[model samples]
Target: MTNGDDEGAAGARNRTVAVDGETFVYRRFGGTGSETVPPLVLLQHFRGNLDSWDPALLDVLAADREVIAVDLRGVGESTGRVRDNVTDMARDTIAFTAALGLRQIDVLGFSLGGHIAQELALLRPRLVRRLVLAGTAPRGGPDFHNWSDDLFDTSCLDNPTAETFISLFFSGSTDSVKSAWAYLARAGARTGDQDSATTLEVRDAQLQALMEWAIPDSSKLERLAAITQPTLVACGDNDTMMRTSNSNLLADRIPGAQLRIYPDSGHGFLNQYPVAFGEHVRKFLGQ
Candidate 1:
């Protein structure tokens, strides 16, 4: 195991494993509690690392079940060339799960991770015991550009500024924006190491994938019904990038899928309101 300094204040335990010729690092919490509880697998959004997830949120969820958050390929401590699409990342996820010997785990994904989660559930329905998708869409389409110019222009990848990244995550009215900025600043301060090449490659691959990939059509929607696992679809009412309506549509389409909407929240609602998000997730996974 390649060990690094523990981000102690966060209370996250990090571990690295070899999966499909890559070194994938994951942070785990609460898995050691008891054998009766099932483990939860967490998937982060685009360019997100394990540290991107709130440690407090994982701690809360761990009270009832073990929580595992992964840093996807080409991100954080995970190794591999930059992936071109969600499919590659999804494959990496499957490989990681298999390598870790995790069977029938509850799965949760947010934003870009949500997209990959959907693909994973569809591809390997038996591996997932339950599913939760936050601020995610079934298929990327015209909705990708639904955000206001102000919001779109504030994207961190396009212009890497502390303010731009912070604004892209949550609504201006969110009180946690300061904390979000602090987190981003800490993450940014650790940037530009030997892993800089990996970050750039990942960014380029993501851009290329976004430009060329088209979401599978409504035909793929039929597969959601085939998924026997209990599924939850959630989004913030104020989500601008992916409309709440899209989440509703997904919930309505999938058999027995539950939908929840956070009031006055945006795309990054999970991080914006970790306590509420963790509560909802805990209940759903516990069921």
Candidate 2:
């Protein structure tokens, strides 16, 4: 449980709760400030589980307020069928919060997680206080629909190696790759009670969700207007997976949303710039 903020993410225990007959695994930690600051909920990328969160970044974000990182249904040790659409995923998350008795929360969604976060905020506006969208895009925006040929060539393998993730999240530049390896090392530092890997079912379902959600409809941008919560959109300067242009568009669409672009990074820029980005997030959250 990481009481008294002893060691942050790596030391946080895996907790369980039953939501609609589904046992969900999650890590809850760092709830150490005024009650006015709501907890932050993390939504992972496609095929990512609770362990997918970079410990360094988690520690940064959890410094003041509590952070809840879950394994979404059918991923990792969570017991349920993974859905083929973000709406169901969001619904599952909403149910999860109800089971935990959380009335208000802040959300940080990365990659495909960003999709679910958007729907969550829209569907349950009063529940979500603020939003952080990283390495993601809006519904039906440029470079949002479909995967690139390079991405198609690498993703959805039965087993993925460190190199597979390194290339997928960072650019091929010498520095970017170097940072990626460092991130891998830090993210893997948790020694015991680690989370399980996401299954192929989760992969296929998330891919199908992306296919349906990112179908480039400019008119859909109107949906962002409904998100009156303070928002922060962040990404790398060169995110091939979710192009940086999408960040610009996302921030533009969401009234008063701020955008940040990390230099010389890609989709995993938050991990690469954990210290800076974490501080930035904490400041934005203002705990």
Candidate 3:
């Protein structure tokens, strides 16, 4: 695998894989534990590249098993026409894994990435051994489209600044605000080899997919029954984008799936409480 040195303390190598002529950029972190375990693959939030991830969470997760965080096609360093729906994105994810010869893996999908991860597991159940769905909900239901027009407007604005992220991802609580700033500082620590910002075209395409996923559909609810893989569902009590209720719905529908609700946090709760969240994830995946 083509690799680069750990740009920050995350101890991850920036790498890329060619899958069906499309180049998928990913960061590969070699965990300090057993190599026989399946790699934990991360799918990013809407409009977020690898750089948007918290090194705190990645480093903690990487301590026990190999981890790979990727940029979807047409986002950041990946090369391809951006997909318009979750299914297509899931197909691309499968192809990306196939290119790397990864037979079994665990998946952690955040926000829109969680939607794609659900589709991926349903499309190829055996490929995913376990699943982590954070700040997201299953497809379907009118309320599932609870995100307001302004939230979308602000998030998709050209050249989003730290202020935009603070508003979109965190609760208004003082602690949450402090957490957001600290998370941003760590996530932005890699000054060299930073990824390009996602374009308007990519954002529009993702928004289209999200809207479609929100349409009420019984089939989507039915598909939840098919997700027999061990699942962990996490969300903040105040996730305005996806909403906290959606997480409850997922936990209630998916048999044996565990749910975690972090108080006084928003969509970026994982970043808000990385140590606690990471430890919970470690225990879940280790089971």
Candidate 4:
């Protein structure tokens, strides 16, 4: 991932591309790498847009490879209403990539985007050259019980204050809480563009999806074995929302997948530790 300062100066050029009858906003940066290097496709988390990704992180990753981050449908500047579930969103991503005429690209997906990325690889294995799943899970199983409906309802639709988000998403530690809040304030201020109503709707729909979601079971996990691309599964050691064990399960289930655990961080590990996060991803893709 690229650093913030460098990203502001040299990140990919910004543009809007059409996918699945909808226009999506995307940023493309860095094309000076070796000819053999595939372009990198970045996927953002739930309710997040391209801007939600740290510019600095993007800059770092873009230093050696072409990086493209897109706004998923119903989020950011992309057109249409947000989908009600991850499968539909994943389909949208596949359509988005096909529309761009990309063949064999390295992909990094965070949180909700990670789920979608996995679906994309399962649905179209030939297109993904490498895969990274961060702060996410293979399925929305019983693990989501840690998050309360009230908390989910509160955090989803309204642009939550840093304190509120930290309380809900991070482990209840002073340092973690403080850092989470700070990151939230900074990221939210920089990337937060949700209106009250839109935020609320997005939140409600996302929670509804999660509350009703079920992992595709053994059959789906078996399908993951069909993914031939090198895969990395990572999460913060302290992520209360999605435990490190979840990432381990994904790694163990996916044939030849690598697992990385970031210490002293929570769900937003990428933002909390961008340099390390970018390095892990860069190395994975390099392999």
* True-vs-predicted CA distance for residue 94, candidate 3, Å: 0.4
Candidate maximizing lDDT = 2
Query: RMSDs, each prediction?
Result: 4.1, 1.6, 2.2, 3.8
lDDT of 4 by residue, 26-91 (tens): 776664433367778888766666656775577668768778787777676777877878778778
Candidate 2, lDDT over the whole model:
0.88
Clash totals in order: 0, 0, 0, 17
The better candidate by lDDT, 1 or 3, is: 3
TM-score of each: 0.84, 0.96, 0.94, 0.84
Tens-digit lDDT track of model 1 for 222-264: 6667767789898888777666777887798778999998776
Candidate 4 off by > 4 Å: 1-13, 33-35, 149-154, 172-198, 215-219
**Between 2 and 4, whose TM-score is larger?**
2
lDDT of 2 at 241: 84
Name the candidate that leads on TM-score: 2
lDDT of every model, 2 decimals: 0.70, 0.88, 0.86, 0.70
**Candidate 4 Cα lDDT to native:** 0.70
Q: Look at candidate 1 and give me any clashing residue pairs.
A: none
